[model samples]
Structure formats: C-alpha cells, structure tokens
Target: MLYIGIDLGTSAVKLLLMDETGRIHNVVSREYPLFFPHPGWSEQNPEDWFEQTLAGLEELVSGADRDKVAGISFGGQMHGLVILDENDAVIRPAILWNDGRTVKETDYLNQEIGRDRLSEYTANIAFAGFTAPKLLWVRDNEPENFARIRRIMLPKDYLCYRLSGTFATDLSDASGMLLLDVKNRRWSKEMLEICGVTEDQLPQLFESYEKVGTLKPELAKRLGLPEAVVIAAGAGDNAAAAVGTGTVGDGRCNISLGTSGTIFISSRQFRVDSNNALHSFDHADGTYHLMGCMLSAASCNKWWMDDILATKDYAGEQADITKLGENHVFFLPYLMGERSPWNDPMARATFTGITMDTTRADLTQAVLEGVCFATRDMYEIARSLGVHVDRTKICGGGAKSPLWRRMIANILNIKVDVPACEEGPGMGGAMLAMVADGVYATVEDAANAIVKVRETEEPDPELVAKYEERYRQFRTLYPALKPVFQEIAK
Candidate 1:
C-alpha cells in the first residue's frame, strides 16, 4: 500500500508519497506567500494552504496506482491560530507561530496569570508564539473577530477539517496550543477557563496515527482518490520530525536545523525541567518528550550566504572553513530573537572577539559553531534533569553540510547519525499514515522497520576539548549582554 505525508510548512506545502516498505515514490512541493502586515506580525491565508496542498496532492499521486494509495496525513507548522466563524469560513489570515504581536498577551499570561500556575495547568509557560496568547491578542485587540470565533485550531488541523470534514487534532499538535494538559494528553479545564472558552470550542483530539475520518467523498473524487481514503490525525512538525528520525524510544534524540531549530529528546516518562528551559510535551508515539527550540537556525546561515554575501552556493562559502574550533570570533545566533533557554525576544545577533587576524572562514565557522553552542545550551539543561544523550539523529538543510554536521558532533561531543532518508516531518507523516492503515503495528515498529542510518559523525576528542572551552565562553556572553539588550530595546 502507499501512504501520503504532507508537511504544511511556513513557506511551502511539501507532499511525499511512500510505499508500505518506506521507499519514497515521489515528492512534490508548492510554495505559498507568507505575509507580514506589520513589522513583527506574520500571517497567511488558510485558504492558500488548502489550495496549495490539494494541488500538490494531485501532482503527488498522479503516476501512482490509484488502488495502492491508502491514507493521507500531515505534519504542520505548530501554534498558528486558525479561527472559523459560525459558517465555517476562515475569519482571518492565520496568525503564525513566529508572529510576535502577542508579546503583551504573553506577558499577561506569564506574569498576571502566573507562570507557576500556568505551568501546573498546561506543563508550559507563555511565549509570544503560543496559540493561547494569540487568542488573548485577538480578544483584546479585535473584539469583533474574537466574538465571531466559533472554532479554533492549529494550522494543519484546519486542512484536516477541509479534507475529511472533521474538526480534529492530534495530541502532539494540540500540545503546542498552551491549552493542553500535556502530561495527561487532554485539554486543561484551567486553561479553557483562562482562554474564556469551553471544550466545545476545541477540536476533537486523536493520537497522531489514528484515523480521524475518511476523505470527504466530493473532495476525494476531485483529487482522483478513493472516497474511502483515510485521513490520519498527524503530529506537530517537531514531533513528526522526531518520529521520522527514529527518535521514538527512550533516550533517543534528534536535532532539526531548519527555519527553527529544535533538540528533541524522547522518553517513556514525563518530566519537566525545573527552570522551564525545555518544553515538556507528549510525543506522537504515546510517550513524552522534552523539546528546546530556537527561533533561528539554518535561517542564520541563509541570511549570511544569501542576503549578506549575495551568493546562492552555500557549499562554496563553507569550502574554505577548514578551521573548526580555533576561531577567535564568536557569533550569537539570535537573528530572530531567541526561545528555549534564554526566552528573550530583545536579544540581538552579535559578532564578538573579532580581531585583525579574523578571516572570512573564521566568521563563517562562527555562524555554524554559534548554532551548535546554542543547541548545547539546551542539551545542558536536559542533562540537569538527568537526560543523558550519547548520540543524536540529525536532520534539516543544515545537516546536508558535512562541515556543519561535524561541527555539531564535535561541539556537542556526541555521535550524529545521518538517516538514509532525510525528508524529516514529511516522511514521518507518511509513516503515521501507514500506521493508521495497519501497515505497521505501532509507530515504534514502523520506525524500526523503516528508519535507517547510513553514516555517523563522531566527535574528535581534540576538537571536542577546544569546542568545550569555546562553549564555556559562549554561554557567558548571553547573560552578560542580557542587561545591555534590555537597555537598548528600552
């Protein structure tokens, strides 16, 4: 049987077709415009996502045997607020996960509502990107729209609704809404009260691999698909990416260096970091995981290579970066501000300790090293909670760079495994669909059968030692500059 996985990303909808044995048949991508109406606001038309995704799906399944295609699922950008009115029409362009207009609402939730109480209720505190804050922002600023909201959902759930005609979301995707009791995998009553909504306002929840409903007959017929094709409740992007990398069982870890970077550590037991440095959420595999995310990751490299250097050949720029840990210059990868350990929106990127001896190679090396160090900062906090990670599966565009892969391996001093298929969340979504169709017994069984590492990057002791010293200094700069960043923003 064949299954389809759709990655509903910030900039594009990526669709993949995979056989039951996990071999990819074809992949299709459709780009959509991302809107920035205000300086710090991000929005996108929900209709655009559905249109592009459907277009991509028609292209994805065109050449395949129609009878072989069994199921479809999604892995999507998390925490985007998608509201529908009584008529089930999209009320507005979705307020995206990266949008920062909710800073005031975030402050109210984290301060006036109290972080400890919020944490107790939902296993997380407020961030400007979380959906609950977006709801509060709507309630406070656009009262008419808020009053018109008859349904609320995450980005991909909106697509699932359109495809299957079911208002549904998976636990992993719902966990990011700041309204779920993540530990219990249910909606929190306290959070519902805080958001001024009831259970009726939320979508029905399902496990990531469970079949939500069959595709709507008319919609399926239009796409040349069987009306009986099942739609599985897919996961949040990070969780799906983790599953794609086989980071499902205990102690498994994966680092994604996409537009946003996340260090995901999967476990059987649920545990929250005392400092709240990492997000504790339910995994798609019916377990728990801790994730630390940074708003900017590979985007920093893209900025330097594309906008700053005016070059498209990323490999050509990195070809000369021979020196790894010895560079005197250090860069703070906070171009999009920061999340996870720091949680500071005012933090700005900085190039420190550059001397006359600094070369273009040195600066380039710093950018890669800076991201690795930032990832390690979260790794350190997970260690504090007794989460020991000896190795990690690596994915994303950054993982394509051999030098960056080695840098992450050495800087974190752990083995970095490159999977045979590096499609990330898109592949994972397909796997979830396969599970929903009974191609596999469970997510873990599907992972064990499909996921494979072709090679591994091992850290050099000498390089690790040098990078350890550099990381020590890198950790200090953020704290020392915290006060300066606040003053400048003021």
Candidate 2:
C-alpha cells in the first residue's frame, strides 16, 4: 500500500508519495502567496492552501498505483489562526505563525493576565505568534468577525477538515495554539474562557498517527484515491521534522533552519524551565519536547542577498566569508521580531560594528552567523535546564549550506548529523500515515526503520573556543539593544 504526506508550509504545499517501506516514490510542490498587510503582519488565504494542495496531491500520485494509496496525513506551519463562520466559510485571511501583529494582545496575556497563569494553563508563555493571543487580537480589533467565528482551526487542521471532512487536529500541532493544556493533552478551560471561546470552537484532538477519518469521498476520487483512504492527524512542522530525522525518545535533539529556525529537544517526560524560555509542547511521537523557535532564520539570509545585495548568487556572496568567528561585525536576526528565549516583538534586525573595512561578504557572514548565534542562545537555555545534548540532527533550507552547518556545529559545540533523506515534515507526515494504516506498529518503529543518518559534521575545538567568545558577545548585544528596541517600538 502507499501513503501520502502533505506538508502545508508557509510558502508552499509539499506533497510526497511513499510506500510502506518508506521509499519516496514521487514528490510535488505547489507555491502560494504570503501576505504582509503591515510591517510585522503575516497572513494567507485558506482557499489558497486547499487549491494548491488539491493540485499538488494530483501531481504527487499521478504515476503511482492509485488503488493502493491507503492513507494521507499532514505536517504544517503551527499557531496560525484560521477561523470559520457557521456555514464553514473562512472568516478572514489566516493569521500566520510568523505574524507579530498580536504584540498588544500578547502583552496582555503575558504581563496583564500574568505569565505564571499562562504557563500554568498552557505550559508556555504567550508569544506574539501564538493563536490565543491572535484570538484576543481579533476579538479586540475585529469584534464582528469574532462574533461570527463558529470554529477555530490551525493552518494544517483546516486542510485536515477540508480533505477528510473531520474537524480534527493532532496534539503536536494543537500544542502551539496556546490553548492546549500540553501536559494533560487537552484544551485548557482557563485559556478557552480567557479567549472567549468554547471547546466546540476547537477541533477534536488526536495523536499524530491516529486516523481521524477516511478522505472525503468526492475529494478522494478527484485525487484518484480510494474512498477507504485513511486520513491521519499529523504534526506541527518542527515536531514532524524531529520524527522525520528519528529524533524521538529521551533527550534527542534536531535543529531546523527553515524560514523559522528551531532547536527541538524531544523527551519522554514533561518539563518546563523556570523562565519558560523554551516551549514545552507535545511531540509528534505522543511524548513531549522542548522547542526554541526564532521568527527568522534562512529568511534573514534571503533578505540580505535578495533584497539588500540585489543579487541571486547566495553562494558567491558567502565564498569570501572565511573569517569564521574572528569577524568584528555582528547581526541581530530579529527581522520579524524574535521568539524562544527573548519573546520580544519589539526586537528588529540590525547590523552592528560595521566599519570602513567591512565588505559585503562581512555583512553576509554576519547575517548567517547571527542566526547561528541566536540558535545557540536557545541551546544555552536547554543546557541550563540540564538537557545535555552532545549531538543534533539538522534539516531545512539553511542546513544545505556547508558553511552554516560548520558554524552551527562549532557554535552549538555538537556533532551535526545530516539525515540520509531530509524531506522533513513531509516525510514524517507519510510515516505517520504509515502508522495510521497499520503499516507500522508505532511511530518510533516507523522512524527507526525509515530514518538514517547520512553524515556527521563534527565541531572543532579551536573553532568552538572562538565561537564561544563570539556567542558571549552576541548574548550581550540582545540585552543592550532590548531597551532601545522597546523605545523604537514606542
């Protein structure tokens, strides 16, 4: 039998076709537009996701044995607010996970409502991108739309509903909504009441590998799939990527350098740090994981190269950056504001310590190095929590850069393992589908069999020492500029 993995990303819907053996038969990607109405605001149309996904799924399974396609699942961007009216019509453009328009609402949740209360209810303090804060923003700003909202869903859960005719979301995805009582694997009553929402407004919760329902009959037929094709509730992108890299069990780590960067540490037990710097969310494997997410990662490099430098040659720009951690220039990668340890929406990207001698290469290197430095900031938090990580599995667009991987290795002072096949969330979604179809007994069993490490990038003691000093300097910049950032916002 065959399975399909649908990764509904911020920019595209990536569809993958796989067999029970985890062999990828075919893959297709369809791009969509991302909207920015305000400086830090991000949104997308729910209809766009469904339309492209429909096209991508058709192309993905085109040459495969259609009758043998047994299951379909998803891995998607988390925390996006996708509300629907009573007739199931989309209320507005989806407020995305990267959106920072909820700063006012986030402040109300964390400062006014109290971070301790939020942590007690949701195991996380409110970030500008979280759904609960977005809910409050809508209620405060768009009262009419808020009144019309009959259902609330995440970006991927909307796909789950459209495809399977089931209003369901996997626990891993729901954990980011800031509504789920993550440790208990249920919605928090306190959060629901605070957001002025009911339990009925949310989707039914399921484990990542659980079969929610069969695909909608007409839609299944349209995609050349059988009516019996099981639809499994999938995971959030980072958690799903962890599953794809086989980073499960206790104290396993994976670093993702996509549009947003994240250091995900999977654990068997539930634990939250004193400051709540890292998010304590349910994992795709039905356990729990601590994740630190940065709003900008690869996007910083993209912005520098495409928008600032006005060039398409990203590699050419990086070729001259051989100085490593010895550079005097530094960059703060807070273009869309920051998350994880900082959680400061007022933060903005900056290039500090540039002199007359600084070339384009120096600035370029700073952008890449800055992202690595920010990642290390999150790593330091996990270290403080006694989560010792000697090595990490790496994935995403930025991980393709040999220079960036070396930087991450030395900065984090850990061996970086590159997976044999790094399809990330898409692969994990298919693996979850395999489990839901009974192709595997469990997600771990599926991962152990399917995921393999191709290569390891080991850290150099000399480079690590140099980066240690660089990171120490990087840490101070955030604190010094934080007040300035707040003032700038005002």
Candidate 3:
C-alpha cells in the first residue's frame, strides 16, 4: 500500500508519494502566484491552489502504482482565510498568514477587547496574521463579501474540501486561527461571537491523523485511484514539520528556519505562558505544543545576499565568515516586522555598531547571529515556562548550512540534531497518512519507526559564553527601537 502527502505551501503545492515502509517513491511540485494588492496585504486565489494541486497529483502518480494508494494527508500553510459562498465557490482571494492588513482588527482584539480575555478564550493572543482578525477586516472593509460567506476555511482545508468533498480541518491547523479553544480542543464560543461568525460557518474539526472522508469519485477517477482512498485531516506546517523530525512526546523540540523561523516544543500537557509570548496550540500527535514564530528567518539572509549583495552564492559569501560570535556588528532580523514575544508589525530590520573598519564578513556574520539570538529569545521563553529543552532537531533551508546550525547550537546552548530526511512538512504529511491507513498504530509510533537523525552539532562552551554576552546586547536593541519603529510606520 502507498500514501500521499500534500504540502500546500505559500508559493507551491508539493506532493509526495511513499510506500507503507516509509520509502519515498516520487515527489512533484507546482508553483502558483501570490498577489499583493496593498503594501502590507497578501492574497492568493483558492482556485489556483486546487488546480495546481490537481495537476501536481496527476504528475505525482503518473508512473506510479496508483491502485495501491491507501490514504492522502496534508501539511499546509496555516491561518489563511478562505471563505466560500452558498454555492461553495471561493468568495474572494485568501488573506494569507503573512498578510499584515489586519492591524486595526488585531488592535481591536488585543487592546480593545484585551489580550487577557482573548488568551483566556483561545489560549493565544491575537496577531495580525490570525484568521479571526482577517475575518474582522473583511467584515469591516468588505461587508458585502462577508454577508455572502457560508463557510470559513483555512488554506489546506479548502483543498481538503475539493478533494474529499468534506468541510473539515485538523486541530493543529485550526489552533492558529485564534478561533480554537486550544486548551479544550474546540471552537471558542466567545471568539465566534467576537468575529460575528457562528459554529455553522466553521468546518468540522478532527485530530490531525484522523480520517475525514474518502476521496471524491470524480477526483479519484481523474487521478486514477480508488474511490476508497482515505483523506486524513493533516496539520499546520510547523506541527507537521515537528512530526517529520520525530519531535513528539514530552520535552521534544524542533526548530524550523524557513521563510519564517519557528521553535516548536511538544508536551503531553497543555500550557500557556503568562505573557502569551509563544503560541499554545494543539499538536498533530493528539497532544499539545508551544511555538514561537519569527516572521523572517532565512528570508532575511535571502534579502541580504540576493537582493542587496546581488549574489546567489550563499556558500561563497559564508565561506569567509570564519569568526564565530565575536563580531562587533549586530543585526535585528525584522525584515517583515516580527511575531512571537514582540508581535510588532512596525518593527524594521537594522544593523547597529557598524564601524568604517567593519568588513563584509562582519555584517554577514551579524545577520546569521541575529537570527540565532532571536531563536534563543524564544528558547528562553520556553525555559521560563519550565519546558526544559536540552536539544532540538533542526530543519529548513538554513539548517542545511553547517555554520547556522553551529550558531544555533552554541547560542541556545543545546545540541542541534540534523535529520537524515529534511523534506519537512511534506514527509510528515505522508506519515500522518500512514497512521490514518493503520500502517502505524499511532503518530508517535510512525515517527519513532521512520524519523532518523543524521548528525548532531554539540554546543561549545567557549562559543556559547561569547554569544551569551552578544545576545544580552541584541535583546536590548529591539525594545530601545520600539518607539522609533512606531514613529517610522506612522
């Protein structure tokens, strides 16, 4: 038997085919356009997502044994708002997770309604990117469209509906919507009232590994598969990536350094920080996890290297950065504002302490160190909550860099384990499918059986000490510049 994993990403839909034994047989990707109608707004057509995914699925199983496919699951971009009309047609372009157009709505929730109440209701504070705020924005700015909404879906849930003909979402993905009572694993009634939505407007909820429904007959026929193909309710990208790294069970940790950086910690018990610096969400493994998300991670490096430096030679540029934690320059990794801890959309990236004698290598090293220090900020928050993390599995593009991995290990003073398979969320999605197919009894069982670590980067005490002093300084820059960022935005 085989399983399929669909990773519905921001730029593309990635499909993976794997057998019951966890061996990947084929992978396919299809790119789609991301639209920006305003400076801070991001949108994508839901139709484009379904079409590309359909096309990609056809290509994914073109030369494979389609009849043996047992189940399909997903790991997708979370918190994007996708509304449908009575006819089940997309009402408008989806407002994406990175979209920052909900400032007014976010303020209304966090300040006017109060963060304490919001956190109590949802176990998370409002961010501009959450689906609830986006709904409020739509209600206030596009009342006509809001009036026509019959269903509210997340990005991947829209695909799930198209494929399985079921309107459903998994706990991990729904948790980020600021609509789930994560502590209770149900929709928050207060949030529904606050957003002017009802229970009927939301999709049915399921655990990440639970089967939602079988594939639609038409879709099954088009893809040359059986109509009995199970559709598993998958998880948010971060949680799925955690599963892919085998970061399940209590005290497990995974760090992803993709376009956005996230520090994900899994726990058997549900816990929310007093300040709500980290998001308390349901895990894909039927447990719970805390996540701290940074808006820009490797994208900051891409901006500095590709946009500013005009070089695609990331390795070539880093080759000269031999000096580890002794740089005089400091960088704030706030290229796209920031989240987790600060939640400031006005924050801007900056390089401080650059002297005329500062070399290019010094600035480049600062960029990498800045991201590591920012990660440590989240790690510190986790420690403050008594979630002791001695080590973390590392994934994403930046994790591929030995220098960045070393920096993370030393700065956070933990062992950074590199996984043998770095496919991230897509691989995790397939694992969930295996669980749904009964090939594995539990998510943890599948993870334990399949996930493997290739190597570990142990922290150096000397380097850790140097970074400790540097991080002290790095932490001060953001707070000091808060007013400045606010003024510039105004």
TM-score of 2: 0.99
Pairs that collide, model 3 = none
Q: What is the C-alpha lDDT of each candidate?
A: 0.92, 0.93, 0.94
Model 2's lDDT to the true fold?
Answer: 0.93
**RMSD, one per candidate, in order:** 0.9, 0.9, 0.9
Candidate ordering by lDDT (highest first)? 3, 2, 1
Q: Candidate 3, residues 56-145: lDDT per residue as tens digits? A: 999999998889999999999999999999999899999999999888999999999999999999999999889999999999999999
Total backbone clashes of candidate 3, pairs 3 or more residues apart or in separate chains: 0
lDDT of 1 by residue, 1-490 (tens): 8899999999899999999788999999999999999977899999999999989999998999977889999999999999999999999899998887887888899899998998999899988788999999999899999999999999999999999999999998898899999998999999999988789989999999999999998987888888888899999999999989999989999999998899999999999887777998889988989999988889889998888888898998899988778888999998867888887777889999999888887888888889999999999999999989999999988989999999999999999999999999999999999899898989999999999998999999999999999999999999999899889877
| TM-scores, one per candidate | 0.99, 0.99, 0.99
lDDT tens digits, residues 1-490, model 2?
A: 9988999999999999988887889999999999999888899999999999999988888898899999999899999999999999999999999998888899899899999999999999999999999999999999999999999999999999999889999999999999999999999999999999999999999999999999898997788789999999999999888988999889999999999999999999999988999999999998999999999999999999899899989888889989897989999999989997899988999999999999888999999999999999999999999999999999999998889999999999999999999999999999999999998999999999999988999999999999999988888898999999999898
Report the Cα lDDT for residue 93, model 3.
99
Shift in Å, residue 161, candidate 2: 0.4
Cα deviation of 422 in candidate 2 (Å)?
0.6
TM-score of model 3 (CA atoms): 0.99
